[model samples]
Target: MKIVNAKEAGEQEIERLLTKAAFDQVELNPKIREANRKLFGRDMSAAELVRQIVRDVRNEGDKAVIHYTELIDRVRFTPEDFLVTEEEFQAAKDEADPDVVASLQKAAENVRRYHQEQKPKSWMTYRDAGSILGQAIIPLDRVGIYVPGGTAAYPSSVIMNAMPAVVAGVREIIMMVPPKNGKINPYVLVAARAAGIKKIYKIGGAQAIAAMAFGTETIPRVDKITGPGNIFVTLAKKEVYGHVDIDMLAGPSEILILADKTADPVYTAADMLSQAEHDPLASSIVITDDAGLAERVAKELEKQLADLPRREIAQASLDRNGLIVIAEDMRQALHFANVSAPEHMELLTEQPFQLLPYVRHAGAVFLGAYSPEPLGDYFAGPNHVLPTGGTARYYSVLNVETFMKRTSIISYTQPALSDVSSDIIRLAETEGLQAHANAIRLRRK
Candidate 1:
């Protein structure tokens, strides 16, 4: 990991250090290009390849999804094989470990309760006599959630993404996951079932997103798509934004810790490695004023890395993206964290709550050493699908409102129209909207 003194680092150097790993066409890795060459007999960026796949699925529907599944995933499936049958669900239930299933059910209940509190109710108020202005909260008719598969199965993702929609009173929640050897992960299936997800599809990647956004013969079109996936999936979500709503353009996981001498070096190092193990692109950074604590955390990271099952990936991530900065004081460390706008931020200072008000940008803030990032990821009753790539400055964690739509309600009696007609006409005329002015003029007449 790189270590630097923030007091001595130039502003531009700090900015470059905080910049996210770019996912644009120009940043396409050699492996992605190699895959494109093997698949298409030509070099193509991930964005271009996603565009082609999205276009094919939009135009060809089920046939295109099947074709891409065979070509990209080396799995052949007909329309009938697209949907996971009740038999498969039952099999997954039977095959799943009873203890893990029970634990998932408990986690699902926690998630369900948390999101239930976030559900918004429709409300109205009559401020003027004979006039009604309000908002109607309506759950989406159907939503599609994409759970990542292949390298690993994320059953927790199913719980995190599905529970919010379920709590929002969505009529249907459709889940899609990549299949391995023509089979979806039993744990994922068990999690979906526990979360009240009725419909499951054995599909993944950009094609799955395209299928949901545009709809195939077997897959119904969804009003929105949520959950995280690879670059192709992210690009596909970007392409289909107007056609369907998406949660956010998620990137690799990240965590930043602001610590002081009082912070436990062991706990801080474990928290950093938690995010570092997520992906090779994942970033784990620490900013502290205590030089001795910084050195201890560094040594602790080395000791912890040896025991992690994903040590190679974590080590690569720490080597390439991790950083330890010696700040002048706590104020400077907090400033650095705000500028980064990390997906997860931990306050390991002596008085974490005292610094809480100063945290301006972070998807989620874990206060003190006890509140580890993984606690929120698994069972803390908070959504783990957070904004990445500094998007926490604007984007938010997935919640009930993400699956619900709000519509403005307007009602005006003849008397109310008469009261506002003149003002409406004046505004419309000022804007040179003759039709809008005429409509109000006729109403008055």
Candidate 2:
């Protein structure tokens, strides 16, 4: 990791350092191109490939879904094999360890209780003259959650994505995961069951996204789709956005730590490595005013990296994206953090709450030394599906509201209409909407 003095760096250099590594801006290396050529006999970008896959699944339905599943994943599937059977669910339950099952159940309860507080209720307010006006919150009919599968399965993702929808009273929660050797992960199945999701499809990749966006013969279309995936899956969600609602176009995982003299180097290094081990594209950064602390943290990272099972991946991530900056003071550190708008921000100051007021942008903030990013990812009640790639400036963490729709309620008695008819007609007429004015005029008459 490289260390730089933030105050000495030029403004242009600072801006460049803060910019995120966006997928659209990335170029495929020769290795990736060769692999693509071997698989599809063409060198196509992720976006182009996703476009073709989404188009095929939208038009050909189940046939195209099966074809792509076989082609990409090398797993042949019959239509009957698409939906997970009750037998599979029971088998998963039986196969899962009792301790792991208990942990998932406890995590599910924590997630449920947290999101239950966010559930919106249908409310109405009465105005003068018996007029009623308020907002009505309605749950979506159905939703699809994409769980990444193949090398590893994320049961925590299932809990985080499904619990919010369940809390919001969504009629149906459908989950999709790619099968490995014609089998889904038992832990993922158990997590889905714990989250109250019954509909799970044995599929993965952009094809799964397309199948959910446009209803296939076996898979039902959903009002919204939520989850994180690889670049292909992210591109598919981007393409299918107009057809179906999506949470956010997620990017690689990232975390930024703002530390001071009181911060522990060991804990800071461990937290940074936690996110770095996630993927080669993941970013981990630290900004601190103490040069001694910065050096200690850097040394600790090197020591800890030796023991991680995913050391190669974490090393690549740290080499490419990790940085330690020496800020003149805590104020400068906080300024850079807000500008970065990282997915996860941690404050390791003596008084973390004192710095909380300075946090204007961050998907999730972990305060104090004990609160690590992984805590929010699993055991914590808060959703771990956070906005990434500087989108925290506008987007939010996935919550119960993501699975709901709000309708404006408006009611007016004759006197109420009479009270505003002239103003309404004038506004409509100013906009050259004579029909709108006429409708109001006729109603008043």
Candidate 3:
């Protein structure tokens, strides 16, 4: 990790260090490009590949989904064999360690309880002349969550993505997990069951996204799609966005730690690795007032990297995207953090809560040394799915509101319409919208 002095580095240098390319600006990965060569007989950008895949699935339905899954994932299943059956659910439970399944059940319960508290109400108010105006909060009919096949397949994700829609009274919540061989991951299936999601389809990749977005003979079309995947999955989501809702154009995970003289070097280093292990693009940064603490934390990071199972990925992440900024003071540290607009902001200072009031942008804020990043990732009640790639400046954590839409309600008595008609007509005429003014005028006459 490069350690820089805030006084000499200046805002421009700091920005150069922190700013990542937008998700659309990223080029195709070489591995994915090579894979495309084998599949499509040519190398193409992620967008081109995703567009073809989406069009194929949208046009051909389940046949196209099966074709891609068999070729890419080396898994084959007929359209009838898509959805997870009750018998399959039982077998997954039987195969899984009871202790692990029990833990997921408890975690799902915590998720349910947390989301239950977040009921956005449909409300109204009485206005002058018996005019009633209000907003109605309505839930979507169906939602699909895409859980990846391998290490990224955290059962916690099932609860995190689905429970909010469930709490919002969504009629259907389905899940898609890429199958391994002929079966889905046992733990993921167990979590889906625990989260009260009945329908499970063992399909993944761009086809899985397309299947959900447009629906197939067997797969039900969802009102929205959530969860993360490889570049293809993200690009597929981008192409189908207007057809359905998406969580965000998610990018690499990131964490920005704001520390003071009172922060713990050991705890600080540990927290940094938590995000680093995710991907090589994942950023782990520290902004501190104390230069001494910076050196110790850097050394501590190297020491921890030696024993971690994912040391290679973590080390690459630190080497490429990590930083330690020696800010002049805590206020300066906070200023740099808000400017970066990180996905996860950790307050390792003496009073994290006091600092929280000044935090202008972040997907989620973890306060104090005790509240580590992993706590929010797993057992914590807050949603783990967050806006990344500095998009937190405008986006928000996946919450109950994501699955809902608000409709305005307007009712006016004759007196109420008359009271505002002249003003409305005048403003409409100023905008050169004669038809709009005529509508009000006709009602008045």
lDDT of 1 by residue, 104-205 (tens): 999999999988889888898886658999999999999999999956789999999999998888999999998898899999999998988888999999
TM-score (C-alpha) between model 3 and the true structure: 0.95
For each candidate, the alpha-carbon lDDT, in order, equals 0.91, 0.91, 0.89
Query: C-alpha displacement of 55 in model 1, angstroms?
Result: 0.8
Where model 3 places Cα greater than 4 Å from the true spot, the runs are 22-28, 432-435
Cα error, residue 368 of model 1, in Å, equals 1.2
Query: Which regions of candidate 2 deviate over 4 angstroms?
Result: 25-30
Instruction: Report the C-alpha lDDT of model 2 over 21-120, residue by residue, as the tens digit.
Output: 6574444535556767788899977777889999999999999999989998889998999999999999999999999999999999999999999988
What would the TM-scores of all predictions be?
Answer: 0.97, 0.98, 0.95
* Error in Å for residue 348 of model 1: 1.2
Clashes of 3: 0
Which residues of candidate 1, in runs, are more than 4 Å off?
24-26
**Candidate 2: residue pairs that collide:** none
Worst 10 residues of 2 by lDDT: 24-33
TM-score of 2: 0.98
